[model samples]
Target: PAVPAPPVPAPSDREGGRDDDTRDKLKQASAALDRRDFDLAERLANAVINSASPPKQRAAARLIHGQVQCIARNDQEAAQIDLRGLEGFRAMKQRLLNVCRKHGILGR
Candidate 1:
């Protein structure tokens, strides 16, 4: 008896799967941040940034990246990220910048 070939995934399905993985990565990065595991968070954020994520997702990833930089006192790198109220993370960007300013890490 001939065995049937396995079904192939549709393009949308593949994209959806990728999206899901991105979401999972974001969640894990956020969790790592919460745990103060900056190394892990940075790695995950880098993965997201290097991926073909939508702008908003990329922004979120950048947010994570920026936070890690700030926590490590790498203000120069943090400020280089163009996180100015775009791509759906406006509040976080503003808040983070404000915190950086208060900490004297970010110059006004």
Candidate 2:
């Protein structure tokens, strides 16, 4: 009998998968923001936003990016992201609302 070739790993199993990679990137971005590294946070969040990530991931990235912009006093840019997409994520939406309120991006 001929030898059979080994089965290839699924996309999600390859090198910890794209979702994992993107998730990790988002976590790093959040950490950078926590560390007060605005530039790195923005870059990392933008990467996630521009990637082929799922809608939830993209929404989270946008929230993080908007928060960074708000912190940097770029209220216009921060307010440009319509957070309605995050309505399903109640906690995240609340956090965004709080951030916007604190930054004056949203009316008190």
lDDT of 1 by residue, 1-108 (tens): 999999996689789999999999999999999999999998998899889988778778887877777776567655556355234676767766765666566666
What lDDT score belongs to each candidate, Candidate 1 first? 0.78, 0.80
Off by over 4 Å in 2: 1-9, 12-16, 82-87
Candidate 2 residue-wise lDDT, 1-108, digit = tens: 999999997656764688899999999999999999989988998898898888889888888887886777567545556366566777777787788778777655
- RMSD per candidate (Å) reads 6.6, 4.5
TM-score of 1: 0.75
Per-prediction backbone clash count: 0, 0
Whose lDDT is greatest here? 2
The C-alpha TM-scores of every prediction are 0.75, 0.76
Q: Indicate the residue-level lDDT of 2 in model 1.
A: 100
- Which pairs clash inside model 1? none
